[model samples]
Target: MPSLLAVCAVHALRPDSGSVGVTAIDKRPLDGEVRVGPLGVRADVQASRKHHGGPDKAVYAYAQQDAEYWERELGRELAPGWFGENLRVEGIDVNAARIGEVWRIGEKVLLEVTMPRTPCATFARWVGGAAARGWVKRFSEEGRLGAYLRVRRAGEVRAGDAVEIVSSPLDAPTVLEVYRS
Candidate 1:
């Protein structure tokens, strides 16, 4: 049955760090919904043309392996262990999620899947990976990693919360399809 998964920490830029304690948000399925939650909460950070905060800008649960090259390229180490995703889902398959899908965290907070995450140069440098570009490209091709989402509702979220899918778009598109087009 559909149930809430582990609410992961939300971080920006740095993979070995954490930010915004988002826990216990409510996520339920719904119909005829476009903007699932709210804005600013899941909205992208415009700092230096980069997106931060919110679920959309959140990193995936385990997409850092591809960034293995960074360890060598940058001569540094990455942290956060294995749980790479900002949110660790138990039931819902993040990769299978479609664009415009909304997830409720706790009672007031909400998040909607917008588009698949596309890595930037900063991420490559962090991991010290040389072929960072190729790693990102392969990730898109495999569709193993999930997509970026925007915040529909702004609130606090934490772990051990139910992630109820409130809405999902019809004719759901794959991350690759969405990214390619």
Candidate 2:
């Protein structure tokens, strides 16, 4: 079985306060069973619906200086940075997933790679990294970044849910491949 990444849920900024909208009605957890729609969930609070804004709409994983990378790059113990991915999956590299591929979550949920996640100005402050702006630019060049997907089918998803790639488009582009070209 092949896997494609999907954000089970996300925390959005409240319209007024600087606080995160974690428990809003539109953001509440579903009861572990639902159907995927064309535009995804019509409601604002569900996981799939939130990603309508592209990358900013969902996650922001980063590959900064980590203990693993540092050991290879500089040979020292380094703190790893977490990208706030809803599912911290290992084994499969989400960044390398190709576009127009259909990723199924658990059993019911499905996502289609519609585009690459383009970093926005909001990320500069979101990350607080001094070189975040430059980092995003370099990531674009390396083509090792993830993508933005639209919900082809919406359903309840959990953190440890297994994602599977059900379809791969022919001559399609990976997120980075699309970005680079």
Candidate 3:
């Protein structure tokens, strides 16, 4: 019953820090269907491939519920893709999603939950400067890190598409548990 609230991607950018970056972390909602390939959403780029973007971590999804919680805590409006998620979804417990879970988006694109997103220094830098360290600490302590997914079937995905869980392995750990460990 969960649905895709947004699909987002971003182009490369050069930060003021004089470093070459492709931190597509600042994504914006796409208006129409976007291709979902084995690498990830079409045109989405990762600044640091050493830590992100691979066959096992192609796509990232965040639950709207968790965003709402952060909005309240940060006392600021958190929009879709605010946390650099490729997919903003609703009506699903992303924190409870286990590894090996398969999600069929719309009628085509299929994705499998692979792991939880671990907070990184790049993320902290993207969020804030001096306070970034504390932000990462708080975020880790919250244990609400979103899920990373790998594409199982390539197809087009769009906002409002239904997300159906086709399978979830019983032996796998939930996203929160993975974050804690």
Candidate 4:
């Protein structure tokens, strides 16, 4: 069964985040349950409304498998939420999730896969150091960052929650298809 590994949200801001100036990309995993709404995890800050945060981009999720891949490539261990993902999951291919596919997280909160996260200059700067060099280009080529989701039903969420796929639309594009296009 697919499970939510962690629930991450902005704990602070980085001032020199390239184009964005300030960013909430450096999120930290939270303890206990958290309330989630149409806008996303309550109190999670999105520095740029134009680039992020809204009904469609309410929650961002990255698969632990993908993060592990990066861990090996970057030759470093990564903490939960390091990728700015509200939810880190395992046993599900988030990149292959189809657009409009709905998921029931835990006993509540129905969310729909909306799109894939687009890497920006802010993300590159947030990475910093040798990894930051051509980071965006390499990330784009990899194209398995994560998926953005819209809340279909507001509810509470926490780590260790079961993630159930409730619906998948054959007509819709997969998250990876949308990302690479």
Largest TM-score belongs to which candidate?
4
Q: How well does model 3 score by local distance difference test?
A: 0.87
Per-residue error at 166 for model 1, in Å? 1.3
In candidate 3, stretches whose alpha carbon ends up further than 4 angstroms from where it belongs are 11-22, 129-133
Query: Which pairs clash in model 4?
Result: none
TM-scores of the candidates are 0.56, 0.59, 0.93, 0.97
Candidate 2 or 1, higher lDDT: 1
Query: What tens digits encode model 4's per-residue C-alpha lDDT throughout 1-181?
Result: 9999999999898797356678899888999999989999887989999989999999999999999999999999888899988999999999999999999999989999999999988888877889999999998899777999999999999999999999999999999999878
Clashes of each: 43, 5, 0, 0
lDDT of all the models against the reference? 0.49, 0.47, 0.87, 0.92
Give the poorly placed runs of model 2, Cα more than 4 Å off: 1-88
Candidate 3, run of 10 with poorest lDDT:
11-20
Question: Per-residue lDDT tens digits of candidate 2, residues 56-145?
Answer: 333222223211442453344322222333333334555666777777777787777666656433333344445555655654565545
Most accurate candidate by lDDT: 4
Per-residue accuracy of model 1 over 1-181 as CA lDDT, tens digit each: 3443433333333332213223212222222212223333232222322344444564343333333433444466533322234444555666667787887766666777877666544444433445555655544565655556677666765545567889888798855577777
